[model samples]
Target: MADLSTLARPYARAAFDYANENGAVDEWENFLFIAGAIVNDKAFRTWLENPAVTAEHKSAALVDLYDSQVAGDNDSAFKQLLGENKGSRYGNSISYPKVSPALNNFIKQLAEQERLALLPEVYEHYRHHKAVSLKQLDAYVTSAYPLTDDQRQMIQTRLAASLNASVVIHESVDPSLLAGATIKVGDKIIDDSMRGKLQQLKTQLTA
Candidate 1:
């Protein structure tokens, strides 16, 4: 099979373009994140894999799930003001009509194409596109130990400067790294760890 990212490209590009054009990129990101998570659920995945389940039914289920989650916040807010029963009833009735239409259509489009399994990939690709368009990067750093505040700041600054984009660092400690760290952003990696150096030296010696 083709790579999942390859399959996700067109849809991700389309959604990103639409969202970017409408100044709704962030909003769409939030929507995609939620939708992706829902589709990624074990229960949902099982149902999704059932050949007997119609696409329209899957689409409706996704739409309903998305709608209920949004409305749930409203339900809570209403409950705080008007008490439980009345609030929940009112909130449940109050569909995110304006928001729902766009999402409903998007989900329906995916279903029509039998491509709903692509949501998680779509979201990931969409997020990557978003980051590029916004001049932001998500960087992962694995080190031998926790990064101090100064170390974190220095890494963030250097990465931002080197990449020419705003950088957000996610740190993990892997003692096996022995020393130093590896930074990953998108498809790029900067490996400066003792483990990496040893491996490179071993490869050269073997060669």
Candidate 2:
């Protein structure tokens, strides 16, 4: 894990910088989204795992798959970069985006050395990077009590105002919450529930 973090840091930072410079954060996000999906696919994952297939073939396959997805300059650059990377390190868990030849070389060194799978952690860290740049917060709301659309909107609006960022929300019913609602915005929490209230009281009494 330490090794994976070490490998992922520079790559993630480079991608973040590129996205910021080019104002292509959304584009990069989409590309990463698609590429990650492809890499995670059973067939594609198998192909990447197979040592027999040359790196060129894998790179070609990806380029063909994403032929019209990105602009011409980006398409060529990324394809060549990833192709070389896949070839150099035939198999090992990795998650760094192939930003360019230089970065790809760095990742190849990491992969060939068999550091560890860094993709999941990289994605998590990158999400935070993106969120900060985009000024967006993702919230997961679980409620024991049902919420009306108006109520949800009010809460979201308040949260957005307080955080000074846009909000993306997902809602679910959690009977175990016992009452009120629990909202998680990034690493922050706003828990307003009977269970939470009880815990507060218990803590105060013990203290």
Candidate 3:
């Protein structure tokens, strides 16, 4: 099978384009995040996989789930859009009108293709697109202990300067590192951990 990211590229690109054209990238980002969470849930996954459940039921369940979550927000645009498209159909494809047109169309297409499970991958790709367009980077920082506000700010400042883009740091604690930290940006990893140093030393001695 193709990689999930590979499969998601076109859909993500389409969504990004639509959102960008309408200056709704952030809105789409939030929508996709919520939608992705819904489809990725264990209970929802099981329900989707059950052969006894029809596609219509799955789509309706998804629509209901999305509606309930977004309805309480002060922004009624999404709710109105969703309501307009309620029970709307495109030759067996479920439609979610009143919500953003682009998103509604995207959801309908996913339903038609039975590819709803790809939502998370699609959201990830969409986020990458959004970040690139905004000249931003997401940095993953792993350390022996939780990072302090100063440490996070310092790393963010340095990374922003180095990358020439705004940087968002996500921190994680991995005690197995023994000490020190590792920073990951895209495909690059910079490791300064004691464990990493020891491994390098062992390699040098063996060599």
Candidate 4:
């Protein structure tokens, strides 16, 4: 497997710069979303990898697709720039070069090595890196009922005390949880939910 973080570093830095320079964080966000969609599409992936298709053709197709979906002031110019450079030699390359030349060159190097297929993983790592850089923690908490502000604040305080860092919580109501709350901080889950408690009881009974 590719070292996904290494693959994503340049791209992430490029995106950060692009978003910073243009004050277009929203644009970069949309751009990455579009790039991810294109990378994940089977037909697009095949076209990018197909040796029979000329680079020019693939590039043109990408330009059309991106121009239509990635709505922004400089989007058309971005597409034109991509078309001029020729489509990436790598099959997994994401055309998010609107913000940074260094990012474009980095991905181009990956393309030459035919490592473009790792773009999805790279993107994942990129998000994590960006989150860390911004001092933000991405977390999801699932609960059977909506947590009151007091309850949420208590949990946040506990998490901060335990993890030694403040967290911005993303909470969701999942009636399927039955009752109680399940807190997830990064990859760690504190499953205080009724479902989890029952499962533990069941396991212990069987044991």
Candidate 5:
């Protein structure tokens, strides 16, 4: 099977192009960022994978989520159905007051094809596309735990200082790293995690 990123690229590009044509690239980026973060939750993934939830329901759930946040619909029925805002924890989101028809279809297609799980990958690809178009570099940060605002800023600042173009930090968590973090900027990767060091040591010993 193709890797998740490979499978997600076309979808990301389609969405990006659609957004660009409609003068909504930034809006799409913001939406994807929040959607990607929401899909990153383990609990939500488990729920989304449930066989009981239909494809339409899957798409509807996401649309309802955005609508509620954008419209301030305190009485959204789907919120109760989705679980106490399974996505409410994420902040700094750009709310969408009106979801475009193309955007709605995009989510629906992803759901119908059981590709919603690829959201994070799709978002990553979308970010790459957007950054390239805007002449910005993207830095990916993976850590054992979430970074505090100061930590994030420090990393962003340090990376920005090292790079020629403006850099944006995109973060994710992977507890299996055991400790510390890994940073990737374009082709360069810095593996500063305990797990990475252990693997390096093992490789040297085997050699």
Candidate 6:
């Protein structure tokens, strides 16, 4: 089978193009993010994988889930059904104001194709597309400790200048690094950590 990312690319691109054209990139991003999270849930995954569950049921369940989360007082029948079944396996939590028709159609298409499991990959690719379109870059920063606000701002400033684009930093801690930080922008890594330096020295000695 092809890789999940490979399979998901077209869907992501299609969704991104649609969102961009409609000037709803952020809205679509939020929708996909939440959808991806829902699909990634253990219970939801089990439900989706169940052979007995019809595709229609799965699709309806998901749509209902989203609706319940986002629907208002002027609730649809589906929302009412979800309310009645509130104690069912899928517990309700946070919700938005509405689910757009575009999102509904997108979810329906994924359901029809039995490709809902690819949502996470689709979301990742969509994010990449969004970043490129917005002239923004996502930087992953790993350090031995949490980055202070000042440090984060400094890194973002430098990265923005270097990449010639808006930079968003996501910080992570890796205590094994001993000290310092590593910044990953796309395929490139700026490894300034002590552990990285040690590895480079070891590689040189071995060479």
List, residue by residue over 57-147, the lDDT tens digit for candidate 6. 8777776766665465544444343444333332245244466888888888898899999998998999999889889998999999999
Query: Which residue segments of model 1 deviate by more than 4 Å?
Result: 74-98, 197-207
Q: Each candidate: what lDDT?
A: 0.78, 0.62, 0.78, 0.62, 0.80, 0.81
Q: After superposition, how far is residue 94 of candidate 4 from its true place, in Å?
A: 22
User: Candidate 5 — which residues are off by over 4 angstroms?
Assistant: 71-95, 139-164, 168-184, 189-207
Q: Best candidate, lDDT-wise?
A: 6
TM-score of each: 0.78, 0.66, 0.78, 0.61, 0.61, 0.80
Q: What is the C-alpha lDDT profile of model 1 across 1-207, one tens digit per residue?
A: 998779989999998998888777766665676668778889988999898998899898876765555545655432332223222344444433324466677778998888898998999899889888889999999999999999999999998898899997888999999999999998999999999999999999999
In order, what is each prediction's RMSD in angstroms?
7.5, 9.7, 8.7, 9.0, 7.0, 7.0
Clashing pairs in 6: none
Q: Which stretches of candidate 2 lie over 4 Å from their true place?
A: 1-6, 68-123, 202-207
Q: Candidate 2, residue 149: CA error in Å?
A: 1.7
- The digit string of per-residue lDDT tens for model 5 on 1-207 reads 999999999999999989988899966766676677678889889989999999999888887777666445454433332333333443335234556778889999999999999988998898788878887887899999999999999888888777756777778999999998999987999999989999999999999
Better of 1 and 4 by lDDT: 1
Clashing pairs in 4: 92-116, 92-117
Cα lDDT tens digits for candidate 2, 1-207? 356566666656776676678675654554444455566667777767777866555554554455443334443444444444334422223233334543344335434543213444454556668888789888888899778999789889998999899987778898887999899986788989888988999999999
lDDT of 4 by residue, 1-207 (tens): 547657766766666665667665544544454565566789879877988866555544544555564333444544554343333332223444343443444445555565555566555655665566566575578999999999888888877777666577887999988999898877788899999999999999999
Question: Model 3: residues >4 Å from true position, as ranges?
Answer: 49-57, 73-98
Lowest summed-lDDT stretch of 10 residues in model 5? 78-87
Clashes of each: 0, 0, 5, 2, 0, 0
